[model samples]
Target: MLTRHFLALLFLLAFAPPGTCGPVKILMLGTSLTQGYGLPPGVEIPALLQAKLKAAGVDSKVINAGVSGDTSTDAASRLDWSLADHPDAAIVEVGSNDALRGIPPAETERSISTILAKLEAQHVPTLLLGMKAPRNLGSAYVRSFDAIYPRLAKRYGTMLYPFLLEGVVLNPKLNQADGMHPNPAGAKIIAEHIFPYAKALVRKARVRRTAK
Candidate 1:
């Protein structure tokens, strides 16, 4: 009985609700990757991330704002609409469609930079996901496009995931039939890799809230 009570107390302390809002709200703003693409509902990165946070004793909410084939330009246009919820943080994953549609790398960078700037002005924490340029786009485009995320991250002091699908994109077994998005298993891999960083961000937010 003593041990049981002790464990319960520990659990309560570890998963204690944060002040005021009660739960950290995170917005995942990306493309099909955030939407879970080929996977069913609740199996996507957002859902998986929420579950991972819960298991880690972090109380948080993850909002999925992914649209298929969305480019940085599209995201920039929709940025205000997406901010309606006033999330505690956001994970930005644009540029894939920009690369696929042969949009100028400079254009992609400009749009994404604008997006980040607006979010930063609001003091919303952000995690940037970088995507590689398609090989066919040529080395010049690749260098220019691929460097966008890191550069923007440095400028904005945002956390960067390097490549959103680092472990799942190239693996045949992890992708869907169209070879663009991840299947359920692939989403799991993505969730596992990104979960830690996201949880840390949420916990840090909770700390800040408490300190205030």
Candidate 2:
């Protein structure tokens, strides 16, 4: 009887469903737009994402790895350290600063590509948020910069959320006084837009965990 019970217990443990062991960890790697900028604590994109996951009954933790003023290059530098937490998935949101700085689009592409490659090696599912260069940068620069995200996302086989700001950018009502960075309400809109993709990532993570 004791031997039979032991075997059953082992089988149960081995087949336990994903998320039963613990909450899935999601890494949000990005810039000030991701950091929540002037917004107070608990109002950033990561926080908003966490709340949504919980409300939807998905057991998950969103790690805020955002750094204000960070460009794609900066994000690339810290990716290995961020991956130290061993996130089941990640959201890449950098590049706005790179555009603002007029960094060559190729350089921005290389940095973002590096980040995606590292994430792929770890087998972590990723959702990349794209950014468009300011119109003032002229048609040529805009064209080059905007092309980077989709190209890299395709190359890396990661999910893509075209235009991070989407409905929030250029609307005075949505931006902070600096005409950049979303206000609280604006942040909510972003959270709503990204929730679907993030949820999909969570599901993918759970599926991968179950398969393992």
Candidate 3:
């Protein structure tokens, strides 16, 4: 058994590509929803995603950099700190607060673009999660805000999950009392929806593990 274990280590050392670190750190940058808001511990979006990924056989540590009430601009301002972990990949989920606060879509676009640029420069794979503007925000505002994610994704050549809240938004059972943030049950669904895109990010992050 000792010799077998030693051989395994030797094999890995011989085959593993030279890189700063392995593809195991996954950072999630977002707001209250990812922070769990009113939900209990270990039930937040990032946490649930981590669990899901583990179940899928992708062992990763998800860094939940979610700050309640954070807007896209706010998240952008802290991008450097968030990247300090040197994560192999990142999930960009801010902008919901910006939409709720009526921040200009162009401003949100610029902030998110900056974040994507920084991540690209660092060679960290990123998955941008989209959010739709409130109905009361009017058609024009809705159109502008709703379009930012795809535009930024195209510009940055990053993966985009069209709508983060997809099947959970506005559903009473899936949301907390506030109806904005998702409940634990809702978070599971969201994680499932984003899993495919996240898997792509993981695959990209793992490339460094084998590439010279």
Work out the TM-score per prediction.
0.88, 0.92, 0.92
Model 1 per-residue lDDT tens digits across residues 1-109: 9999999988888875544456888888888777777788789889999999999888888999999888898889988998998788888989999999999999999
lDDT of 1: 0.86
Ranking by lDDT: 2, 3, 1
How many angstroms is residue 29 displaced in model 3 relative to the true structure, after the best TM-score fit? Answer: 0.7
By lDDT, the best candidate is 2
Quote the positional error of residue 138 for candidate 2 in Å. Answer: 0.7
Model 1 TM-score on a 0 to 1 scale:
0.88
| Whole-model alpha-carbon lDDT for candidate 3 | 0.88
Instruction: Give each prediction's root-mean-square deviation over alpha carbons.
Output: 4.8, 2.9, 2.3
Model 1 segments more than 4 A misplaced: 1-19
**Model 1 residue 197 CA deviation in Å:** 1.2
Q: Write the per-residue lDDT of candidate 2 for residues 1-212, one digit (tens) a residue.
A: 99999999999989887545789999999999888899999999999999999999988999999999998999999999999998999999999999999999999999999999999998999999999999999999999999999999999999999999999999999989998889999999999999999999998888778776
Ranking by TM-score: 2, 3, 1
